[model samples]
Each structure stands twice: as C-alpha cells, then as structure tokens.
Target: MIASNSRAELMQSGLNLIGQALSIFDSDLRLAVANRQYQAMFGLPDNLCLPGTYFEDTIRHMVLRGEYGPQDDPDEAVRIRVEQARTFQPHYLERQRPDGSWISVEGAPLSQGGWIAVYTDITETKRQETLLRARSEELSEQVLENAERLAAANRELAATITALQETKRVVTETQARTRQVTEMIPAHIAHMDRDYRYVFSNRQMPQVFPGTRPDIVGLTGDQVLGTTTFAVVRPYMDLALAGRHQVFEMTHEESGRRIRIALTPDRAGNGVYILSTDVTAEVEVREALTHASRRELAAKITSGLAHDFGNLLTVILGLQDRLTHAGLPLEAHADVQATLAAARRGVELLERIGQIAAPQGTALAPIRLQDLLRDVVEMAKATVGGSARLTLNADLPKERLMLDPGHVQDSLLNMILNARDAMGPKGGEITLSARAAAPWLELEIADTGPGFSPEALSRATEPFFSTKQGQGSGLGLAMVFDQAKLAGGTLRLSNREDGPGARARLRLPLRPVRPQMVLLAEDDSELRKMLRQMLIRLGHSVIEAASLAEAQGLADLPGLTVILSDLQLGDGLGSELATPSGPPLILMTALPPGDPLRDSATGPVLNKPFDAATLAAAFTQVTHD
Candidate 1:
C-alpha cells in the first residue's frame, strides 16, 4: 500500500510540471486528479480542484460566467456539454470565449476509466496558421483542421503507449521477486496436474528425497519418485485432486528420511499443489521423548517393590548368618549355607532390578571397529569356558564411530553369555559380525543354540521377563535395550534364518568423535592414579590435580585437551570450577544418577567407577570440538 501511494504521488508531480493544463476523472466522472496548471487555467477555487469534485459542476460554473460566450439558453448549453463528457469520446475543438480569446481542448478516453483533457492556449499558433493560409490560398481551413486533429491523435497515442510499457515493467518485476522467494525456501514447492504430472517445481525435490531428480518439471510422479514412494502418496494425491486437502508423514526409503507432505487442491480445481519437507530430526526427537516417558513410568512402578524386596533379603541374610554360628548337624549346616547363598542371589537380583529401573545416560565417542571386536572377544573368552568357541567376522570401513563403547561392549557380552548358557555343556560357536549399512552401523551376534521359543522371542527385551527360570535375574536384555535407546540405536532379537540359533542385531547411528588430551582431577589418591593410567592407556596425555584449586591452576595450561574433575573436590564442588577458555570440562561423580550435583553439571558427567573404554568414550562424546 505504501509503495503504491508513493508511485501515485510521483506520477501526479510529473504531470503538474507540464505546461499543458491536465485533469483526469474516474469512470463515475468525478475528478480523480488535477495538476496545478489545470486549476490555474480555469481560475477554479480549491474545493473545485480537489479530487472527487463533479466535472459537471466545473462546466456549469464556466457557462454561468459566460466563459463559452453568449448562449441562447445557458442551462441548455451546460446540459449538452455534460452529456458529451459522459460519452467519453476522443475529441478536439476550439472555442471563442467572451474575452475574444481562443483555447484548444483535446480530450482522450482512458482505457480504465474517464477521459483526460489537455487545455492549451493556442492563440499565437492560430494567428501564425492564419498568416500562412493568407500567403498561400492553397492551405484552406479544412486542411488546417485536419492537421490539428491528427496532431491530437498522435499525442494521445504516445501517452497510452507509455502507460502500457510502465505497467508491463511493474508486472515483470513482481513475477521475478515471487519466483526468487519460492526458490529460496527450504521445502519443496510444486504443482501437479490431475494426471500426477509435475507442471511446475522450485527444483528442491532432490533435497527432500535423495537420489531423485530435481529438474522434474515435466516428469510424472512415478518417474520422479520411484514406484514404491509414489504408491505411498498416490491415494493422497487422488484425494487432493478431488478437492480434499491432505497432510501426512512417510518414510522415504531411498534416503531413509522422514518426510512431511501437504497437498492442497488448486483454486482452478484442475490440479494440486505439493509441499514436502524433511522432518527426520523432528521424528527422532519425538520418539526419544516418548521412550523417555515410558522409562519414567516403569521406574515409578518398580521403586516401592524393589525397596521392600531389599529389606526382606537383608533380614534373611541376618537370620542365615545367625544360623551358621548356632551350629547344627553337618547336613543342617550345609543346608544353612545353601539358604544363605540363595538369599545373597536374591539381593543381587534386587540390585539388578534397580539398575534396570534407573535412568541411563549415554556418552558417545569415536571407536575403532576392530579394537572393539577384539576387546569383546577377549572378555567373552574368560567367561565362556573351554567348551565354547568364539569368532569375529568384520567387514567395516577403516573409520572411527561415535558410540558409547562401554555400553556396546556390555550389551554384546551379555548376549554372548546368554548364548553360552543356551548351548549348555557341549557349547558350540558364537559369531560376532560388523558391517556398515549407511546411516547405521550394523552389528550382529549369533550363537549355535536351540533357537528362541515363541514366548522368549516376544518377551526377551521386557523388563524382568526371562526364559532362564530361577538362575536368571531377567535384567540383562532389558538393560541392553535401555542402553540402545539411550544412544539413539536399536536392538533386535530373532532366530537366525539359516540355522538353529538366536541372532541379536544392534544398529547405531554412524557419527565420528576425535580423541583429545585430558586433565584428571580427584581428591582420592588411589582413584586419581587409576584414572591417570586409564587416560594414558586410551592414548591421551593426562595432567593430575588433587583439588579444585589444583585443577584451576592447571586449567589454563597449554595443550590441555579436556578437564576430567570429580564432582566433590576437597576445596570445592567440581561444578564450581571456573571453566578455562580451552578444551571442554567433564565431571565425574559416584553420586547416584539422580543426584542434583551430578545432574546440574553444565557439561557431560561420567558416573564414577567407569572403565578405561567408558572414560575414553566420554572424552570423545563430550568435547564436540
């Protein structure tokens, strides 16, 4: 609106500067605009010159003042001229006023509305023409009138052409701006005909769905999006063509991305407008929130039961110890020992339940696939006895991945142990395999055993649901599931398609993390020493500090990659330590996972008693740089 007003003012100013008096009227014959010369030429008052003044009134005022010379009936003359103005015809004429002065009036109708008139005082030009005619009698009045009419027509034509050119330029600029805006938008904007053929596109198809062509203006939906993907949206497209709007989300298989598509019927009812955007990250965050809600509910449900169970085991342990000291027959004593052992197992079961119910935090880091597999194999060998054989088949790229190695190793080891037990005394082989599945690092652990029962296959990952009967705590696979979810990965248990064994596949996002130098701070001398050695083993040089003051002193030291401080230092809380302007700071604490001190730390926190691999993973995961 502001721009349009500015243009109108500029056009009016240009017209006012002209020597010819000019006035324009709307289709209703009311004055729309009048230049300074227009009002002055007629000696009109301000009210008569203002926009919306009736043209008929101006003509009547002129006739009453005898500007058009003596008329037989002044009212009749005003009526005739007013009627002619309404016809809006192009006209040129000269009239003599009571003052004996001649003025020429040339009026041309506007394409959109009423006519514009240019009034010029041509008294001098008329005298010149008369003199020329006298000198050459060949130039008659009829010939002079024809020349004046032609000149008027030519001027009107020029004005019309100028208006047309300006209008065209404005329209072109507007279209260019609209196209530029549509092209810059991140989402795909396109139009498709009723036949599902693309008619227009902003060339962003490939960005939303990888592997698809972007120059698809003339392509059919099937040709641009593949048969499978097109099939998913075909029904929606049909609905949109039927004048019904649709909005939904679907997974794009080609790129493994989630996409949101909105289809709206075109106003003409002959096509549909398409808008698609990548919503993969949004979907992931939503799923994570839902999973966290479920975990919180589970924790709430099990807290009271686990607490009561813990007290009962403690009492049982006390009674068993008393019975052991009371001394009965040898057989009775042995029975008492068995009772104590069973009670201890129950206590251990309760602890496992607590761990499962607790919230799990993930610390991801770069891990060499080969090194991880080697560590898992060595760990499994110690637990699997001589009867079982273990093997690793890896076809992974020579790259480091962002992952929580400790959790991954623990989950893998748990699966291996479960496999070992399933195979019984005459254990067979267990195979661990790794491969890159683009966007995901796929790892599988399969064992030679009686395949899972239907009930086991369905309930294995459920908390406290186990098939191992009395010997199992029923928390191994549950913990594994928690770990997988914490790391934004997935764990699946199924029977091997080709054999009599159960296979567990884990898929985690493929992200890389780089190693860095570390600063180890702990008040406990022994723990500090142990952490220092762990950092060195992980190929990171470490600087040791026994207090917050000591850590602050070394915090600014050059080449210090990261700060690994215990939450409770002798001088102050680790969280209170002023972070240096260098590497990231990570806090370590033995505090329960829900402790405020541990939770309130701004940076990453490693729950105390973490292993070398966990520490290394934490370093890589927390320090983004």
Candidate 2:
C-alpha cells in the first residue's frame, strides 16, 4: 500500500511539471485536466480547457482561425492527436516571435479528445537561419553586380577598339591623299637631312636630271650626283643647313635647261626641304619677247628717219622742178633738162623710201568680188587702150570681202601694166577673175606676157625691189604687199601655168563692211588747202578745222572714220580727236623720232611733204566702206 501511494505522488509531480511548462490548450481541455504545456503551445488563455466547452467546437475554432498546424489536414498527425486523443508522430512545429525567437511544438495525445503540445524556445536557431538566408541573398546580388560590371567593361573595350580602327582608317586615307597631291605637282620635291643625304623625293625627281639618280636616297648629293650637280648646289645646301634659306636660278649646261630651286630650312635647322621648277620654256619665251620689243623699237626709229629724209628730198625736188622749167640757152637747156630729170628721179627715190619705211596702200572695205574685178578691168582697159585686151571673168560667189578699192585697182593695174610692158608693143590678154574660198575671197590676175626669170620672181615684193629698171620706182610690188596687210589679205606671185607671164593672186578676208567718215583736222593754211584739194579730188567732203580748239568746238560734227592732223598746229593738234573720237588718225609731222611734238600727238602719224596721190590714198583708207 505504501508503494502504491508513492506511484500516485510520482504521477502528480509529472502533471505539475507539464502544467508549469506551457499554456496552449483549450479552456475546456484545461478544465478537463489537460497539461499546461498544451495550453501554452496553442496560445490558449488559462480557462481555455473548461469542462462545458466541446472539444470539437474549440478545435474547429482554432482550425478556422489558423491557430492549428501549418498543414491543417484533419487526418494529419497533429490534428489526429488533438481530436482523436491519440499519440502523434513527433513534429517540431516552428513558431516565430517578434523578438527573433522560435518555439518548437511536440504534440501529445490526452485522455480526453484533445492534444497536449509541448512548447520549446529556439531563438538562437531561428536567428542563425535568418543570418544564413540573408547571407545567401547578398551573395546572389554580388554575382549579378559582377556580371553587370564585366558587361560594361566589355562595351567600353569594344568602343575603344572601334575608335582605334577608325583612326587607323583615317590615317591610311590621309596618307593616300597626301601621296596623290604630291604626285600631282609639276615641280620636283625632296627632303634632306643635315648630313646632305636625300631622305625623300617626289616621283618626278628621277626623270628631271638624267645624270643624278634618286635611287641613292640615303647617299649624299656629292656621291649620288657625281660632284657635278652637287658642286653647284653644295654652297646653297650649306647655307640652308646653317639655318639660312637659299633661293637661286640654275642653268644646266649639259641639257641647256633652266631650273629654279628653293631650299627651305626645317625645324631646328636639322634638315631642309628642296623644291625645283623647270623654267626653260618660260625663260625662253620671256627672252624672245624682249628681243621682239627691241626689234620693234629699232623698226620705228628707222621708219622715222626715212620719213624725215623723204620730206627733205621732196622740198628739194619741188624747187628743182620749178627752176628747171625756166627758159635757158641750148647748151644750158640740156644741163637744166638733165637737172630736172635728176630731180624727178630724186622724187621717185623719195617715194620709194616712204614705201620701204611705212608702205601705204589702198583703203579697206567689204566689197563684192565681181564689182571689184570689173572696176579693175575697166580701169585697166582705159590705161592700156585697145593695145591689150582686158577681160573680166566673174566667177566669184555672192559674198562680201574686205579690200581697199583704190589699192586693189592699183594692184590690178600694176599687173596689167606690167603685162603690157612685157608684151613689148605686141599687146597681150589680161584676165581678171575672182572666186570665193572658205574664209577668203581669192582674186587672180593672170596675163599672157613673157614669163619672169626665177631671180626676178624671188625678190618680186622686196622693198625697192622691182623687175623693171629706169622706168619703175621699184616700190610697186612692195606697195601691193603693204595694201594686202592693211586690208587683212594675203598676196602671192606665181607663174601662170597656161601662160608665159605671171599671176598675181590676192585673197582678202571675208568680214562685215564698216562705214567711215573723215575728220580733216589740219591746222596749216597752205597745207590744209592742198589736202582739201586732194581729198576733194578723191571724192571726199573736207570738213576743215583750222586748229585743235576749232576741231573740238565743232559740236555738230558727226563721228569720224579717220583724223588727219598737222602735228605742228596753231593751238596744238587735238589729242581729243584721237582719244575721244577713237578714229584711226594720220598726223603729218615734220618732227623726228624722240621729238616732243611727235610724242605729243596720240595717233598713228605721217611726216610732212606728202604727195597728192599719197594723201588721197591715206584719206580713202580711213573712209573705206
């Protein structure tokens, strides 16, 4: 009986210990004698296990309110222990607290239909789990961040590589362009070091100087050029190397070529750039132009001398003509006649001199070829009479061409007259014909006379050059040559293939005709009257102005084709007549070359003591149609 009492005390002690442990059981379950641990595990109040309360109703309330197990299956081990009053499989129900603690529940079945779940505090275990989870998340984020950094670095590397390739391409293209520009230059270019060794040269260097080859780029000039070209360039090179730039013109004796070279010092005077240009053609052209200018000046001076001499001879001859005509004894008459003949010869000689110096011919105009030829034939027929037959073969096209009518007539007359002289009283046929060639009007004057010798034909048009002696002035053909030039035409003397005499072929350019008027600006009283008489004889209206002031005062005067002025005038020959009118002028001057009077007149000039025919022809030239 004492042992049975000890067993009952032992059971009571066990119950007391369980009740003090927890409070999670229902009030009804508690009143029905549930363990305190169960009440504490379920978070039940102290009266939750009351006897009148239904166990099923309390458990249903806990289930509905989520106070049951996380796995709320009615048949689960925890649910079976709470409702069926059976032993449950031991499960640690993890419970979390706000202060980071964990409670583990180990449920056990009671005698009544309820569960007695044990409550255990596991704060350190849950804290360890949270730290582990947080550490794991941090590690994953770090891995993502590292990957992003790697991607950014790779992008930057790609950008750097692209930039490097673009720079390479730009450099390559710039080099190519530089090469092209270098080759395009016409001059030779080279670079040299302070040691006088060639570092680089343009493409033209090899061909420019034959003896010096640029293949020896690394060699000094003395070694590569074999001391010839180098000796010429060494002084300049030394100067450049000493920091002074050198520029010079060089003539290559072997090639007879001129070269212009420039040596420019480089930075720090360590090297130099050499540039050379071939100026052989340019130098030659300049020299030729200078020679031409000298010749032209000499020609003008010679012409002026001839003009003054002609004037002196004219005065002498005119006085002799008047004196020789006076009556005298028979013996003296012959001498006087000889003197007159000599004076006449002197006049002809002076005319020849004028022709040689400044040959004046017929005026220029655009005329129908047929009309010009017909006029020549008519005039020739009058001159030749019935001795020689004059015929005109009008085969010319209906086109106008530039010519001087009087000069052309004179040219035709000369040909016909020469033919008549060659006929030697037997007479001969002279045929004047014209035709139109592209860009020219060709006039052919063929005569049936004795053909000329090769010697006579060769110098036919030379000044003071003639076929006839004693009877001709020797300026006829020369006059023809001058007329052809003045009219912008070409003249040729050739033997007639079908005849024995010669053929004079004249071709004038086809151009529009210009209308011209004469402005006779003569200041001398006697000379002005003489010119007016001559010009009137040539069918020109003479508008006579006594002085430069009178000429300028003629406000109603029409524009003129030509101006004829006396250089030594009462008020000075009008420069206005030349500049303002812009007409071709013939100023008659008694002054020589370098004379201030001659220089003052701003127009093409002629010397005084001109013949009547000469003045008439000059007048007609400026007034040509």
Candidate 3:
C-alpha cells in the first residue's frame, strides 16, 4: 500500500511537470484530479485547485474574473459553460481571454464515466497570426479588403474541416459498431446491388449456410449459393429489387439447413438488403409442437372409443373360448375358430390405433447414418430370414445429423418389414440407400417385388388400407408417415420407375454439425487438457476454463463455436453458463444417463472418457441441430 501511494505521487508529480494544464472530472461533476499547471493557467484559488471542487464553482469564478472577455450577463455565461461541460464530448477550440491571451482547450470523455481536459496556452501563436494579418495592409484598399475576406474564408474553412473531421470520426465509429453487431448475430446480413452482386456482408454467410465462403463481397448470388439454391431464391431477389419486400424460407442445399430469408428493397431501388437465418432447430421445435397437438387431439377422440372396443373384444374372446371347449361339428368348430381369428385381428388393430394415437415424443440426438443403418439391418435380418437379402447403399459426405434415433430406426425397420411382406414367400432383394437431398436426408427403400396396383398406389399410406387382404393391418406405411411428419420430414411410396418393384422414400431434415471453436470448462486439469487436445485434433479451437466464473469471463470472446463443459465445476454447475443466444453447448459428465444432471440437459451430453470421434460427433449433432 505504501509503495502504491508512492507510485501515485510520482505519477502526479510527472503530470504536474507537463507545460500544459490538465484536469479530470468525475461523473458527479467534481474535480477528481488536476495538475499544478491547471491552477496556474486558470489563476484558480487554492480551494478550487483541490480535488472535490465543483466544476460549476470553477466556471463561475472564471466568469466573474472576466476570463472569457466582457459578457453582458456573467451568470448566464457561467451557466452555458457549466451546461456544456456536463455533456462533455471530445472537442477542440481556441478562445482569447480578457487578458489578451489565447488558449486551445481540448476535452474528451473517459471510458469510466468522467471527462478529462487539456488546455494549451496559444498566446504566442495567436500573436504571430495577428502580426502576419496586419502586415498585409501595405497593399491598396481593394487588395486589403480582398485579403481580409480571404483570411476570413480561411478561418471558416479550418473550422469547417474540424467539424468534418469530427463527423467522419463519429461515422467511422458507428460503422464499426454496426459491423460488430451484425457479425455477432447468428445470421447473414448483406446487401446486393442491382447487378445481383454482393456489395457488403457481415461475414456470417458461412454460419448460416455452411460451405459458403465468408468473404463473399463482390460475388453474385448464384456464385455464392450455387445453382440450385440460387435458382430457388432468384425470383425473390428479383421481386425485392423491383421494390417488393419479401420474407421466405428455403433449405440451404450445401449445409442441409433450413433458412428463413428476408429481403427488403433499398430506397433507391438499386439494391436489396438481405437477412438469412438458420431455422433448422426452430422448424424442428415447431413440428414437434404440432405433432404434440395432434397427438393430444387424437387421444381425446380415441380414449373412450378404444376403451369400449377393448371391452367388446375381451367379451368376444371369452365367448369364443367357451364355444371351442364345448365341441361341435367340425365345420361349426372351424367357423367358430375363424370368428376367433377375426376377433384377434380386431384386437391387433386396436393396439395399432393406440400406437398411432399416443406416439412417443421424439428424443432427438446426433446420430451417424452408418451406425443407425447397421442397427436397422441387424434388427431386420431376423424378420427377413434366409429367403431375402437386405442391402445398404449409403453415399453421404458426413454421417452425423440431428435426429430421433429411435424414431428413425423404427420408421426404417417398418419400411423394411413392409417391403419383405410385399415380396411374399418368393422373397426378392430389398435395397436401402441413404443420400443427401439438400436440407434433407433421403433414405430410399426399394423392393424387387410386384409393384403396387393403381388403386393401391392411391391409398397405400391410408390407415387400415392394405393389399395383403386379411393378412395385413395396412397401418405400417401410415405409421412411417406419422414418424416422418413428426420429425419434420416426409414419406412417399411409389412404384420404382426403373424396375418392377415398389419404392418407399423417406426425407428427413439433415443438420450436419461443423467444426467450431469450443470453450472447455472443467475443474480437473488433466481432463481439461485431454478434452482440449481431443477437440483440437477434431479441428476445433479450444479455450479452457477451470470454473464457471472463468468460463463466463471468456464467454464474450469472439469466434467461439461452442461451449463444451463438465456438468460439475469448481464453482457450480457448468450448465448455469449455458445461454440461449450464442453458440451451442454440450455438457460432459461421468454421471449415469438417468442422473438428473444428465437427463435434464437440453443440449447434447457426452459421457465421460469419450474418444475424439465421440466428441466430434456430439459437437456435430448439437451444432447442426
């Protein structure tokens, strides 16, 4: 503390030695600090020179002493100076005092809520300028008047230049701030000229639509967005340039992301302002909500009916059991048996209805297509048996996507089973292929079986409409359709135009995660280091924080791709650091899957001791969603 005091005194002494006057005022309008030259230059009294002196008092003193030259109302003059000081922005001006001295005053606001002013005595400079002007009188009257006019003009120009410089400074600052804000937004904000070339961008095009270059200024829309996507948006862009503002959505093909785009015409009609945001997650949430609402309504409609039907089936089964036990003629017994089979089928149909009406909520997570397909194949092999073969043809750049693994597996499995049934005992091959369809993951299941009839084609997806007659419930395709719609996807059935077989196509929204800069927060030093290295190997830049506080401190750092943190930190739960507004977050933990901390996390979770691939896949899933 003593050493700090000595340093402060030394700093004050050095400031006082400067030839010009300097004073700093606090936000409360009192002198916080002043150098010795400030008092000497202003001829201020001792009390006014000390810290805590009110700025108004100092100004009033100067006014009374006529330092600002003769004024009709001294109080009013003092009031003006005090008021101006209250709103002190950076300024520079030279004024002559009543004592025939000139001083140039420059004042600027401090970052911490106050103002600091520097006053330089320019008496000699002003005197020299005056002498130079006086010497011009040697010329004739006309020349002297012209010379005076020129001098006046030069003064005005200097003042105008100063004002222009200030204006330019402010405009530059504002533009910089605007750029910062736009870049920080999780969208692309840009402008395109009449020629359809980008004139400016906020460097977020890649974030909104991955694989697009960020430095896209001077690039045409087609050049930046590729042919297919550009074609989709060309009409909208044209309309905007024609003075029609538009807002629409499109699937960005390159990244498989759903984007909401807004275009507004410039006032001059020479350009359009564009805003495109990735709305994949929002669309998913909306679809889930819609599906939930439908389920609720369906439940309301089916609850009582299902109960009555279940009871009737139970009674029929009991009566059939008694009839079978009480022997009758063989033909009569066969008919009773047939009736029992039909009743059993009705029971199965009721179960199917229940499954459809109360469909489970989708638990979306990052899943690799290859792994999911492998699982599906394993599950379907038993159902397909030796008579038929299931082949997978997967051509996808990145296998990871945000999806409900269970729902997708179930849907695909159902399709496989349906294809098997369609092939009958002769059993032909079933091919399942996965590929990208731009903003959608397309899974095509084709069977080398008799194609659907015209009537079947029209109502294949309808509930209880089956070609298998009494052998099929007809709800298989319907259930697949429901799953796809619930997942913001589509399911379509058609005859394979290339061959004598049926084809079922499923298209689900694909959100592939990209590499990102990760903030890794973990209390264990070894674990943090290990995770950081793993992330680096996975092509992500990692910033490490030991606790929640440290992570929060680094949260505002720019270019953070995501936050990967441990569930438990030195300070508190790392989940507290998660926010809705910024990059995606993934929580890592050793807790069991059922643990509240793990189960409750809304973001992705990586179990402890995960490998590089697992970490990368988790990040990809979270970011893509």
Q: Comparing 2 and 3 by TM-score, which wins?
A: 3
Off by over 4 Å in 2: 1-326, 330-338, 360-363, 366-372, 397-401, 512-625
Considering summed lDDT, which 10 consecutive residues are worst modelled in model 3? 163-172
Which candidate leads in lDDT? Answer: 3
In model 1, the clashing pairs are 402-511
CA lDDT, every model vs. true structure? 0.79, 0.63, 0.80
Q: How close is candidate 2 to the true structure, as a TM-score?
A: 0.33
TM-score of each: 0.49, 0.33, 0.48
The clash count for each model shown is 1, 24, 0
**Per-residue alpha-carbon lDDT of model 1 for 1-625, expressed as tens digits?**
5695587677677777766687777555767677899888878888788655678888888888878877899889999998999999999998765765677888877665477777777665566566666755666675567567657855865675465345434434543565588889999999888778886678888889988887786579999998989999999999999999999998775455789999999876758999999998897787567546655666776686877877888889899898889968899999999999888888877766667767568866557878988999998899999999999998887757767778989889998998998888999999999888767777888988998899998778777677777778777887887788787777778898787999988777766545467778899999888888777766677788899988888888878778888989999998766455566878888889887777787878878778766776666566643
Q: Taking the tens digit of each residue's C-alpha lDDT, what string does model 2 give over 484-568?
A: 6566665677787775877887766654333335567776688788888766655556678898888766524666556677766
Sorted on lDDT, highest at the top, how do the candidates line up?
Answer: 3, 1, 2
Error of 3 at 28 (Å): 45
- TM-score quality measure for candidate 3: 0.48
* Model with the higher lDDT, candidate 1 or 2: 1
> Which candidate leads the pack in TM-score?
1
